[model samples]
Target: MFLKRITLLRENIPSMKKYPFYIPSIQNLEEIDINNKVTFFVGENGSGKSTLLEAIADKCGFNTAGGGRNNFYDVHAAESSLGNYIRLSWLPKVTNGFFLRAESFYHFASHIDTVGAAHAYGGRSLHEQSHGESFLSLFLNRFKGKAIYLLDEPEAALSPARQLTFLKIIHDLASEGDAQFIIATHSPILLGYPNADILSFDDGQISKIDYEMTDHYQITKYFLQQREKFLDELLNDE
Candidate 1:
């Protein structure tokens, strides 16, 4: 628990009508107290989960595009709009961390290759490996010791089994008390980590909710359990 809380600097904002700030959950956000080693941000698209995560990464001096403090490269429109308007309160600050943006991971891999830094990530080029394999390799090799990892939609490249594998990796890192993770994800499997804090960006606010209350969990459970009836209702025209 390096980062103890995230407080929105409402009084410093120049406009309420702007993007990011206008997003309902961010607009209403006062402060988010991070009490768990792993915190999961759960929300629908455009619900402001990723937005806040990106801001925190930016604030941490990690490239908002993706990568750690030293991994610098360019990608269009990669800056965080909300980063400047938020303050992160750290109990014992840590400078070592990584920010992973799923959509721009290819570019990050490219940056690694250009810098000849593949030795740190499993001693093989990320581009040479499958997407899921590269993700796992990065987790296994590079993640270590007193750091915060901010990941956005890591499930993009992972299969169900791979997600389970990722969860085990998370458990190993977190249980050691050496890493903190704040992940923005739509994966029920990832959200099911025992005793993790799940913050929902729904109903125009950010609030802690039980894992079972998430739409991801409820909907996935329903669809799997009642596929025929679920499809019947969906395909039916009222």
Candidate 2:
């Protein structure tokens, strides 16, 4: 399955407006050659990246709590009258995909345990594992080949090393043409996937960017470059 194009129409509802909610208006979205590959969505907090992902998953017919579902809206809908709107012009002509949200892993594990293979988790509940470990185990165990996956902020729970491991897993899936991944992440390591498209959502617009050109990479670079100066300033303060 391939995604051809994706477009957003509206976002960021204002308070005091008749309806104050941040809902996206998306259109003309399509995926191409996505049978086995990865697409990276990069942005800072509150930049509409996760919202777009959730919308896409919803259009793809994944259960709302599963990888493609968006429960964020449910919690915020009462507070914000604005609702999400999406248009998926094209998708993989196949089925069997997931929409995974990093923040909802605990809920996902619980749901999975009830109906799916409870013993596959080695008797260790998702709550028992460290966040990074749990993510790794889930990807390795649950992800089957020939599937499409949408991930929101997967880097949230992963350490840098674990992000690297996630990259390898993605590579393996893509190489086999068994999976396609659309991921929203802040980790430069995960963004380094070769040939993956990096779309940035900032200042109310989205555009393609190079891996090295991302704010995450540049900010991390600056901090590492001036670590000594930063440390000296801190140590000398008082």
Candidate 3:
């Protein structure tokens, strides 16, 4: 694993009293250990999960939109200064890394096409394929492993079946023993990665949780087991 730990330095707390720093989970943040090959960040929107992921990726010098350092495309404004207050510990060697923010991936893909790098992703342009197809193709062809991958809600573009494929692909990457993943997602299937360190950001608190305890898993199980009951409850007018 490239990243060993992440610490939110206390000295930075005073500076978080304003706009960008208003994200509560980041305000109360502590440290997170990167002991496992796969670390999943799960949370509700506005819970600060994406913010933390963005901070980490930005701090580590990965492009804020997506792709490695050399793959530049200026689409987004500068990220929050939160990355400035965070500290990361790493192993001696971190060969390569990529930062992928799901919402911005389309822009990233457009940049790839603009740069005439279709060959990098298996001779097909990302825009030419279905979102899920392109997502899988990216890992299958471009993820040469021995690297760190930071992904934010990659499941946004994946079907359940495709999520499983992504899981398997990531599992295979982890099996190589040199790649590490820090992903923010709401997919139960992705969070089910065995032995992964799952951090939950619910109610503005970041805490470690088991797969079964995740809202994604719990709500999915409830909905599947009693679909009609849930439907009735959800559909019935008060």
Using TM-score as the measure, the top candidate is: 1
lDDT of 1 by residue, 11-47 (tens): 9999989998999999999999999999999999999
Best by lDDT: 1
Model 1: runs farther than 4 Å from truth? none
For the record, the alpha-carbon RMSD of candidate 1 to the native fold, in angstroms, is: 0.8
lDDT of 2 by residue, 1-238 (tens): 4665654334432332342123221222222222226788887787767767776676677655544332232322222121243345445564667777776667777765555555665556776788888888778876777777888888888888888888888988877756878898888788888999887776555667788999988978877999988778879988
Q: Which parts of model 3 have CA positions greater than 4 angstroms off?
A: 93-95
Q: What's the lDDT of the predicted structure labeled candidate 1?
A: 0.95
List pairs with backbone clashes in candidate 3: none
Candidate 2 segments exceeding 4 Å error: 7-36, 68-84, 120-124, 230-238
- What are the clashing pairs of model 1? none
C-alpha RMSD (angstroms) for model 2: 5.0
CA lDDT, every prediction?
0.95, 0.66, 0.85
Tell how far residue 48 is off in model 1, in angstroms. Answer: 0.5
- Please identify which of the two predictions, 1 or 3, would achieve the higher TM-score against the true structure: 1
